[model samples]
Target chain A: MSSSANHAVSYPRFLVRLLSVATDGGLQFYAWMTFLTAIALVGANAWAHQVADGMVLTHMTDHVSWGLYIANFTFGVGLAAGGVMMVIPAYLYDDHAMHDVVIFGEILAIAAIVVCIGFVGVDIGRPDRIWHMIPGVGRFNWPMSMLTWDVLVLNGYLVLNLHIVGYLLYHRFTGRKPNKRWYMPFVMASIVWAISIHTVTAFLYAGLGGRPFWNSALLAPRFLASAFVSGPAFIVLLLLAMRWLSDLKIGAGPIRTLVSILRVTTVVNLFMLASEVFVEFYTGGSHTAAAQYLFFGLEGHNDLVPWMWTSIVFNVVAAGIFLTRKGIEDNRFLVAACVLTFMGVWIEKGMGLIIPGFIPSTLHEIVEYAPSLVEWKVTAGIWALGGLVLTVGVKCGVAVLSGHERLVKG
Target chain B: MSDSADGVSRRTLLKAAGATLGAAAFAQALAPLASWAEGMSSEDFLATHYKELDAEGLKTALKRIEEDTKKKTGVDVHVTADAPIPGVKFGYALNLSICIGCRKCAEACHEENNHDRKTNNSYIRVFEMDKGSIDFAKGTVDYAHPVPQPDKFYMPVQCQQCDNAPCVSVCPVEATWKEADGIVVVDYDWCIGCRYCEAACPYHARRFNWQAPEVPAKEINPDQGYLSNRLRPQGVMEKCHFCLHRTRKGKLPACLEACPTGARVFGNLLDPDSEIRWVLANKRVFVLKEELGTKPSFFYFFDE
Candidate 1:
């Protein structure tokens, strides 16, 4: 290669060339996808008018006050929490191999927060009134309310993480090395913030006095453990997908290391879950009745029992898959294990977490709630929206970091 | 070039003239309220957590309440500055054994709180459960049909106003707090409406106003309590106040008045001869979710 070609290979000049290439077709694809998603969101907003007329437009009734929107919110939060896997490796473990992947995880976190907030807006009858939550303008301080603290912590963490990551990415794109001094403090904060977001969310339900199943002191720990397992599982799947689509490689060694971490976290998650089950059954208190209903299905409310058992089976299977040599080594098997862990966690957290909480309510009543079709569509639409965000975020992140249009160009 | 320059000059002049007039009009609007503006000192309006308010702050707040009531509703409402209930504070006792599940209490609560007429939001929920089933797992609280279904008994649950209210402890802003009177009150103006209190309450006592409540003016109760019945903004949490406005004035709760069977009992627990104390002393009273250790002021009796 000539001297000029070597100069072009330098990170700054390389990024400039990448930018030139991006403007040709890659930028157009990103813009088009964004515009299309924006249009779809507008359509969703119109449908939301019907939801405002009353959840009557949707299939939600008194029995199922929460449906697709809440489930999507739950899933989105899980995805957001998944950012920690990338953070832990790059920051806590000081693994340079995962550094290139960390920025993408931050982008994913931003996308997940958007989806989570969007789903909440759709779930409520009045999205416009969401501003009442803004402090000072409309009574913003409620220390007594876990929901209030949750709102504070989640939004705070989201902004802090996004700013820190975005700052680093921007500097990289501009060919200037970001101040390394800032990175350490931010990395440490990210670790703590990661745990805070998921724990606060778990407390949102666990703090409820009436719902015995959710009110357990184990809720926060269980949430963290599940988040640790599910988050890394998602990152592995994403890395595999990227490798298949492009020349990007998340190295075999780091992948195995992540799998090992996943194995440990999954074991912890299952142990916490088992401990919860044991306490509920053995103590045999007022909460025992709700526990029995969840595990054994009392009085024909067995719909959740089958799902819960399946979730346990899948979790165990996924754990075993990640633990074995062939399972961690084979990319396809790793992907399969990751997918199973994702679904198992979803079922355990979403269905098993929420439904059983309300089963034996404070008044000691079993309210059977099933999501309707409209609820399902709205939910699918939101998930699609989250995927679109991730796609654009990943594209931008890769373009900035790799200094190559080929990685991001449509 | 000269013609374009002239046109630009004209536009700039017009914009400048418009801006001057707008500023003048704004100033004129402010001039009339300049004297009263001193009373509206921004420093005086600093939002404080519920527990942080001092006696002087409370007095000022009470005065502000009276003024606001007079200004907004055109009613001279008496704003009480009394302390919360003493030791034998107000207690609620319900005879679930005799509650026919008429839903009259729900209706009364809706009216008393000035809830949206269309939604008819109520604080109280009466769960009808099958007889001989102690399992809450089998009970269905969400019923489409009307009251008193055959082979079922009714249990009405609302804000227990517990001694150790979880909702009071979790608020980041201290917007909700328990008064000495044993009533859990929320500062509507200070509440961020994050629905944290709703999630924290074990009894599911808290309700969020997702939209600005729309009660008909005529239907609006003129006798408003600052913490209880004034129109709440959207997104903030509200719950049963034990009809604080009426109860504070030595009146019965609207739900108590509406119950035909006289199943609902409300009285000062301090008074030994009070009906609530009598019920507590004699009846087989039970508090919901006792294991949570909330020390609920509300109790249920079997009437046997």
Candidate 2:
């Protein structure tokens, strides 16, 4: 054992050291951070412009009131929920190799939630008045509004993950064995909370009976299934990157386990998509107007057709790759599958799902929406910020877990 | 000078330059927020929800709004927070048989509600549909040269003001609610403008203010109800309240008066002898999207 194990530092000292370790990094780290920060600044500048000018800068009319921002927000909720895929295998099944790197999953969840909240903040017309949703001071229409439930679940999931991750990391930093009582319950809660976050998000759209496109019973399950695919796909990419760049010896065990998870989830996602499409097309009605606009063209407005088809193609190809022998053995094929599935799910769950709901609007007006440049910048900025958070967190977390950084003195 | 002294001076110079650059960038980044802040007063930001405000507080809020309106549009608009009349349950009905799709009511609504002139925004959308069809897919709102076109029947849609309003339930903030008078209203100051209500309305009744409404000073309607047709802030939801400012005070709605064919009917639903009740009892009356079970106070009838 290392000599640092004998040093039992106070909680305050542990935090101070954690901050110091997180901030101090190599030249490559600085370069990556600088790139992310620059992009984030660009996004912020774009958002400022959006706010100063009206929402008119966005291509969203009163017809398609929601567009790219809501799309990103939906995808983000799934990504955040996807993070718990690691936690379940690690804690529930007690897979030793998976447990060793579960912190990365939790860290990803944190970053995702930050991205989710950022998208929501920018999406609202008055970010300044967000405080109105506060429970006591501002009226919160809870138990009624699905949005209120969503707010509760997303924040609750964030807190649960934060506690579990914080408690474990702090203990590991101080060279102490983490008590089960401190974090075990929260980990369990987070697993359920993860499911709730995405379900509630799906329900936010689903509950609107007026929008026949989203008022589906299958929406929540589809969200979870797709979430499992994207979540593990993301973690697999992270594991491969870490193995390549760092001296940390992540065995092939975690990657294999994640790939297997992705195998089931990816196919299930495609199956659900097919089922939805079959139901929409075979039983065509006025309600199928939005779906028709999405898949085919309704009234010659086929803006989303290419996007939807591309998403399906990417998802199918990736699913095919995952079922192959080289998907497990060859690192390049593994990376390719992960990238394809990640992007596939992003499109399928993001713009493909959200934009179509509003195309043939409630009154059957065929207004279309495309993201404005300002929206794209803001989205890029939020993602870059997520990237920065993940990088710094993984760096600090790996340093601690690998025994490179520990408490030197009490 | 010593090498250490020279290093200190160079370091200080770089630090000063960095600070200057940061300050300038920060100011530039916040320029939008600064300009946005200029439009909203601190009082407006800290204003209470309409229901939470006491009578005294409401008086102050009305005064503040009047002053804000004067400052923005140079119009001395009279804004009232008219409470619903006792034992009154407002109901609206349209005579579809005689309706010509003249769009005069829509125009009246646009002018009376002080809507943004650029979008020609209004609470009413008159759909010109085939005489035998109610399929919204076949309906068109963009007809250019139209007034009771041949074989086309006009159906005007507005907020149903449902007993179980989807819009009210879906609001994360109780910025909107069903009042005692059965008129669903929105506290314009309290809405965060997330547009959830817009998505929830089946009739496509709710309108979102994309930017500050622009009405020329002389054209601005001086008579306004606080929740009815008063100017709404940019980035909030607004919809028809059955012209409560006029309807509650024993005056007819601007739209009703503007309908040259007497195709519109309005009165208290609770009143046994009211015109709306008479239409409901005698005419073949139905509510739009009845399958949704919104139980709208608004009705449609045909005198076949």
Candidate 3:
């Protein structure tokens, strides 16, 4: 066990100190919080209407069972899994430059998981009866139902990460060295867990043999490849923003490593997408109607055509920029490249990935989906909630590390 | 982070108290909004699962639902939870040769199942396909012209009620399940409305109530079944239960009775001499998306 955890420390006092970190921030921090709070309130209000009005407010028709809510849930899971990239380098290889930022990745995971769970909360039609999924108390059908497995893994992952991040931060605050025994096994377990979270999410789609678009062997790998690209891109962008905001010394080493990971993953992600596209078009069978709807168009309805093409274009542009020497050397282009890759992967991994699976429904009817204003509001609300969580987590972590905050020796 | 002699500091105590008060205030503020929720009631929220409900619970459930229906829709519905008969495995078949695509069966289903009047949601979809082709994509549901167009043939699609039911396997809460008599049913009250079952169904058999379905009081089919065709909650999933309420009692399904051309066939598949068995034995019967291995009880055959 870590000496910090082994010590005679007061957890109640430690928690109180952590609470104080959230309340303490600058003018800019307050403004950011205000902006997020405003969005969250609007979303909360919209959610109220949705709950009162039923899912009718959303554009999900009889044919398309899922919509933007599920797509965002899928994307959030990917974002959460991306944090492990930082974990692998800092813990496995013991990269010194990565040490300061690894906790930030864990913080990001917490934020993303919060958003993921929130999206799920909003997506369901009956929020009150969610307890039916609770094991022991309800008929959970764990081994039989893939959704039950998903519930178990997601909650397990959240608690596991929270424990690791909390243990490390508390130790740092108390001015004690973290014992490897307390955290190393967890860090290693986390690496595997990170892979499982995304893989399990991919399996959620793939196991459904009914939907031809998602029933592919390539889905899990594609999910991982895209997750690596988007996850690191988000961290790099956040690190850059933090550097501009304060005297946080995030060196070029981690940034270079992130870009390197992005470049390779981007290429691999695009290749997998292309390979899937080739197979879908080459077959030209009835099952390929969903792929046809995504790439070209089905009948005269071409809603998703523009979005899919735009995502493909952005992927190419971002990949090209990342490959070039000047792109890496210039901060502006690097930032632009990261932003582009982030959006590209978001589109590819999100709406671009989920919505098409339902189009040209099982009965071969074209029922398109577009998120209504209420859905967008709730979506924005969840994101804002996530941003607020991340901001608070980062503030506490930064303060403890910088020695601006400390535990009382008494 | 320093602890006082008592344990926690004054500031920490105040902060905790303030947070609790803040939470209580938030809940109080949302109470009026909670009152605004129509159709959903405390009783509905506390309704137990179908599998766990005893005879007394089922009796109370039926009585409560009747009262709830009268209160919400101003329609008195007699909802019964009927058990399946032993030695009965229900099966359905449609004769593509005679189906005229008039969509009367679809209409009958909407009324019988208390489906939304506004959306005209039905358990059945009639696809008008080219006479020479069975490609469902090429089939148009909105041909608009008089159906039985000389160039086209009609196929009405609904839940296959698969023996190896994917919909049953995917329901996170076990809200949907296959009955002992081979018909699949959904306990509307227990569903979380995740819609994963809808996605798993290859036939697009399941329907989700995106809104509180409106049915005129006079048009409402007062006779209903708890698991088969009672008015579903706004956020749950519903589908054809082979009209098990009627079928288990030796009555014909709404769709089979509504068929003007006598195309729909249904029977106890376990009975060796049944008409459905005859169709399976003599006709070149086939099921849609057979590669999915759902083992659908519903079959389609051509007599032409």
Candidate 4:
């Protein structure tokens, strides 16, 4: 027999052979889940302590009222926003090469949403009373409260997208083609929903007149641009990991296409960021004080400068990596580039977005803020929880697709 | 038995039973309203956000207020109807030059409105600017230490209660609204703890209760105004109300009374002889951030 023919037969039996390997992998997965749960429990306990003691337990003082929780929330939002780039190809362009990988994107979205929600819970002093936000019973609907809509859209989108993705995977495992007609509508809805979630979140910051750094017309667009670049970079990095670990081949053609898209999106994001900087400095208005504090460090609070400069450098480097042939083609280089891009976007979207908004605050006071250890550990727990969710989701998806388990076990 | 006496007794018994039933039903219907009315004074009775109470509830509340006012202040204060401006709705004004920066306003505000003592957060920020710099652009309101620096003059800026208030416009849920009497009030229960209003207010007038306010019952200022100083739920936004309970009832704001310089003035702009109107017409009054077109009711002036 020809070597190619032999490989084809063996590949079909790959899952059967890998079933033994999965047993060991399952043990690892359980261990990881247990570790994550323990961390989450500890974090939750600490959070309860914070609630009992008030925000005094947090290192966050009036000057730096918003700290790690907000930063993590912003980072999670950015990560969630990144799902759009992955969706665009599968839904809009109908790229078949991306079909297997699309589930991973949805998994990431689910994980990101959990982290986002978790961060919000930790940030609020009275998280137990969060149900008061429900309409009709407590002040059900507040058109003036962007938070109300954000809750609705974010949770709604997360569920809808997750359901649609789950349904597709179920059918794929059952040896039945998914009813494309049903998924088509969800796909369309997801596109619009994705845009809405990020836009509304941006408005949450941009609408604030007190925080000059956040109060800009460019904010919403800037958010979208950053999401487009960062989201794709994350997906690409995951695809590389999958390529090494599994037999799933995300073709070079798709990687190149995604890289090209990232190249354009990163440019747009950079442009928007530059324009914002120019307007702040050039206008020479009362608002310039906030921008000065963010970039140059007003007074002695220069804590953010090193971090901000690093973000700028990493962003530039990531953009450079996408533009170059060597960076995008080589697997190792691609991983490094994507990792840098992810971290860069995290800093830019997290600290760069939130801290700057409050510095040279409305009162023209430079308040220095840093997150405490408890805050950091809680954030880490939330991140681990997100990863755990994504891992389980991807594992379930892969299992079903490979048809390792019988569709009709009962 | 005397037949006439028996008949009269029967009628009286029937009337007494009917009156008892009527009173019981009235009490049952007014249960929530009555509970709310327990500690509130008459001045505060009429000045609630109005949106909070239904018609029957409002009537009962108003009656309760009248009763409370007579008991507390020992004065007969009439609560009158003042229609909100057609399109203008509500606005606020403050005089920077007249402000002593003593923070009596802030303290009075804290006391009048049950606020968290640890944070000591209040809506009003008294900026002490340099004496020579009449320009607000050169003003430095945030100082690390004690106030009234040698070269400084004080400006107390609270909720501009802007005609075009950004905070009101940006609220995703309609938890906050502008009332007819030129006051911006937030529904404590309705606020989702988003801090959007805090972000939106140019004056930084709004504060979010990160934790439940820790005010002692003794310090709770039993004479509560529902909209101005009622115990707030954690996560909601709050701000200064210009002492709605007092000002609406023809009494002076606590801050105005406490001011050593008598620099503060309080009155209705509609009232021709009202001191606020007089200050606006006679003095070289200027509103903060007039360029932003927030159309603040708070005015600043210097006595020549």
Candidate 5:
């Protein structure tokens, strides 16, 4: 379309049109992509070092076997699950304003799930051995291992979401009406599947009875509450960024609706945290040792004290901001609240939740952990990869929806 | 699919799908070689599940372990993959009255099992407690004294080898399992090193290999079992198997032999006349965390 000679030779013009959008990045887009790609390469290099030198290079030890890698993995799962918040309201209620933005949620989910899988890949010691975890090809002890269930559900959700998104977009690009029968059921299933992914991940921790810090029945509920809070908050930030940068027509209606949802979820998340805290402190059981390490210093290992407190403060302040009508109306205040909420949940759910479960390990040994530089680099890289994927996906999505790209009828 | 110069074609989508699937399948076909280059041999990469191994496959695995040990440690190790003896479920009972907190059993297990020297990992942990309490928080494993204090009692905890093991049930890959003789054994090579079993074990009996174990060439225990005392690879889980190599061949476990007080008893529970059965009959014996219903073969009692 831009050049006459190349346009004349096009056979697969729908794909060509999608490819053109990615290729037609202005200076700003190219710079953003280049920066993301460069950082992603650094992450790849660090991963190479980890693969060569073994996990000893990581901040994790036998005492704290799952570290930042698993932390990010858990967070990534919640992030992916958050997409359903948008889906539930938009499709179920037939809120056309929100429906216009639902595709963004799906795209965000696709990005989050990809990052989740990447984190798992970097976390495992032997990347090549992953094939063994696949069903039928190797021994997958389903109904036995919670991790096996996690693998199944995460992948199943990925495929399910992929189908839903691909079906809608493919129809939109081709100018054909989507068959509601085929895609609507999947959209509904994805809502449940999204919640299930986070619940199962929580169970992955909770099922381990030995780690009393994680053995609580409240964990799954807490995961859902926090996931709903942080997930929507992140979507707000992304939607804001998209609106500012591009002509995405995401009006204030969806943002306010998302904020209201965030408000309720954040309140529940904080309440659950309070519930967990009161039980740990008041009961004075052996299970309190890990919780003790997280809040107060346990036997002089108080490294996480500052981080935990900061997360608590951020969460409390942000929740208050979102609860107020004025804060919801003011874009600046809303942005601050969302950022704080995102950071608060990231720390709370990741290190605050995961690390405490392992500290003062059931054997009562206190070996504190700090993620190594290499671990941070790897994490940053995965984030950059997510950014790149989302950018490319949204570019194509915007193009097809704007009618700049189309499939000619036969 | 028709050629359209002005719009997209179905042919392009099909070609891309074909190319992506072709590349993925081609890469997967060569993954065994890639895995072989990354420390696993082709044989180990292609090795079937432990339960799926037949007599011939087991024989080949045993020989490979022997060769692998020799190559890695320069120690000509005898690696045996033993099967359970039917109708002979093993049981152990510790006489708490006469036991001292020397921790020699812990040391023997460390050497016998080829644990990493840096981590100082041992399957057995001896806790010294005040006479009146069974509370583990009040117990100390790192006592600097030479012998048990006069008023103190010793309790050595290891894998309970539960009849219904939570660790076995939690393993996503079936890398660990309980044999008929009540020994919970881990297939070290097959384990994904997820440490879910370590987290699942109530007794904290499991140890994860953060690095490939380094046993000094001269000190390496040449007697090894494929699922028990063999030198383990990095990122896998290892634990006590009651010294299955020696016990399956009618010898006492290294920990039991190392106990200077002779407070440890090992026997087949199926034999009503065995010493463990007698301990169960005569003494007030109890298994650790029995409320969890793990049904441990290991028991503790006092002679008082």
Candidate 6:
């Protein structure tokens, strides 16, 4: 408001403000960041060991070539897609209160993308040769390979969300009303792009006709349904945290809208799950070997049976909570339902989905997979790194939106 | 840039110290990757894809590979990148009735292709199946009985070199492809080792180099092919290429030559009189997973 004549310094000062906000946190924040840094370093060490030795360190084999890394990568994509839930409500449905907290969801998307990329980077046998997929510089078999499509949609969604969040935050920091034209086009694109990111990820598996467990027409819709559930589940938690930690005046309306979205999505996700389970069990063919190994014991090997059942139970319980009046009226029950849904989807969409696709493999040889210690360490480290990114991003947004940090008229 | 009256504040000094220590620790954690990258020359790292390489570039790559192999294993292997012969399409057929579950073909492939000795890796997997059924689920590859067990039939599987190959289509980079002679080959250097091709193949034909191959200096196969049996780098995909190194040079495949019962046949499908063509004409042959529509060059038949 005071810098009408100094338009040139506005951008430079905005960058300074954005960069310096991380430094303004208190001792508690610094300790949290330090702890995350330590875990991230441990993960880096594990990854370096994996790189030096090769992918043999992972539990993956020629039979089960993808394991925990791909599982987490799939879940991370769903979480990233979850960001668009807020955008659809705030912009598409014209929910004015949701507009206030949409940036946090976008920030969460950015962090989830970082996690997805990290998992993929660690999963590949040749991380150094990743440049071979570059479009012009390398031979990228596009339009045919589902992996290439995943790479494109993931990176595109990341950029789309980044632009929307960046433009809005920069304007807020400069004390200017964001021109709708600047971010609205991107906001709309991100809604579609969000759906694409998860759809392409599902296609990456579903397109593999050899793995009959994943080769279903219902896979894409299930992915979208679960994404809507997990994304809103997470945003509610983020809003509750913001309410507790800061003075961001998040009203009850956004939470109510997100809960309503969850009400439909959680049931839809479970219904799809039921449909998938019914088809696999009732058919009882050679193609149902993976599903047999997943739901019940197959040839005395049932590694995923317990995990799959737990996920189903959690999803059903969470759905029960969301479908009830107490879920909306009681804060404690709401938090529990959110956590259960989040973890339930993590299991269902991750290990519950990816691992079974590899078990009883293409040749009908039942070679099972379980993540090793190094894999777990690397997975944890990536999550910590994501936590760091999300924390720093949200803190900066909170600082700017609260009018506590801005450009100084020197 | 926070400073107190007495030069620098204690808090600022502590923050700087913490930052430097954190940076040092992070570097230590990633030191292994730095050293691993240092072993690869810039030429190998930055080399263009094999198809994109000109004649001179191909020669340079072959020479560099030979030199690297010699330096690492003290073996002077001759690696060739022979082009496919014109008007020739390779086909392979195995007579299931005459085939014994001896695994000699798999052993020959392992030795000829310079596979990792520790894993005893081979492209050919011979499954011993029930007499009246072709169900692969009932077939066991780890059967330890004598050759041609009384009531069992042996069926060996390898890369089918499919006309509509799922592996070729699924590769994000064109690292693996179908060559002119109907042989599916992989350029190990160009493959990113995502193993998507391994998952896509219904035959389970593809194999990934999970670790650096450990063949002894003397045991290393002196004869190699850039697209076939050359010493593969760690962390890439490889599979049966019909022994293209020898086959392209008018020599028979190692597996075929090693077969004692003459159950294996390999020849140009375009040539009507070739043994493979005769097998296709005279025998009731079938390709696995015909429903998937992967038209395989490799076929299996029964004497009946």
What does the i-RMS of model 3 come to? Answer: 2.2
Q: Residues A1-410, candidate 3, lDDT per residue (tens digit)?
A: 56456455656666877778786455787678778877887788788778777889898887877888999999899999998899988878889889888988888999999999999899999888888888887789778888887888888778878988999888887777888899889889888998899998898899898899999999999999988988998999988887887566788998888888887988998999999989988987887889899889889888989998989999999999999996779999999888898888888888988998899888788988888998999999999999999989988877777676677543
Chain A of candidate 5 gets a TM-score of 0.95
Which portions of model 6 miss their true places by more than 4 Å?
Answer: A1-7, A408-410, B1-13
Residue-wise lDDT of candidate 4 within B68-141, one digit each (tens)?
A: 54554454434433334343322234555556578887777777676788778776677777788655455665
DockQ of each: 0.15, 0.65, 0.60, 0.14, 0.32, 0.80
Report every candidate's CA lDDT: 0.71, 0.88, 0.86, 0.70, 0.84, 0.90
Which predicted model would earn the best TM-score? 6
User: In lDDT terms, which candidate is top?
Assistant: 6
lDDT per residue (tens digit) for residues A83-137 in model 6: 8899998999898898979999999999999999999889888888899999998
Clashing pairs in 5: A10-B5, A12-B8, A12-B9, A13-B7, A13-B8, A14-B8
Question: Predictions ranked by TM-score, top down?
Answer: 6, 2, 3, 5, 4, 1
**Across residues B1-304, which tens digit of lDDT does each residue of candidate 3 receive?**
4467565566557557756764574465344348445556777778899989999999999999899889878987888888999999999999999999999999999888888999989999889998788888788788798767898999899999998998898888899999999988988889999999998888988899998788888988998998888877788899998887788789999999999999999998999999999999999999998998999999999886
lDDT per residue for candidate 2 within B1-304, as digits (tens), equals 2449887677557546755865676577667778888877899889899988899999998899899898887889899999989999989999999999999999999998889998999989999998788888889988888487889999888888999899999999999999999999999889998999988888888988888788878888888888888888878889999888888899998899999999999898999999888899999999988888889998999988
Model 3 TM-score on a 0 to 1 scale: 0.95
Model 1 C-alpha lDDT versus the unseen true structure: 0.71
DockQ of 6: 0.80
Name the candidate, 3 or 4, with the larger lDDT value: 3
RMSD of each: 9.7, 3.5, 3.3, 16.1, 5.6, 2.1
Per-candidate TM-score, first chain only? 0.87, 0.96, 0.96, 0.90, 0.95, 0.97
Chain B TM-score list for all models: 0.76, 0.92, 0.90, 0.69, 0.87, 0.95
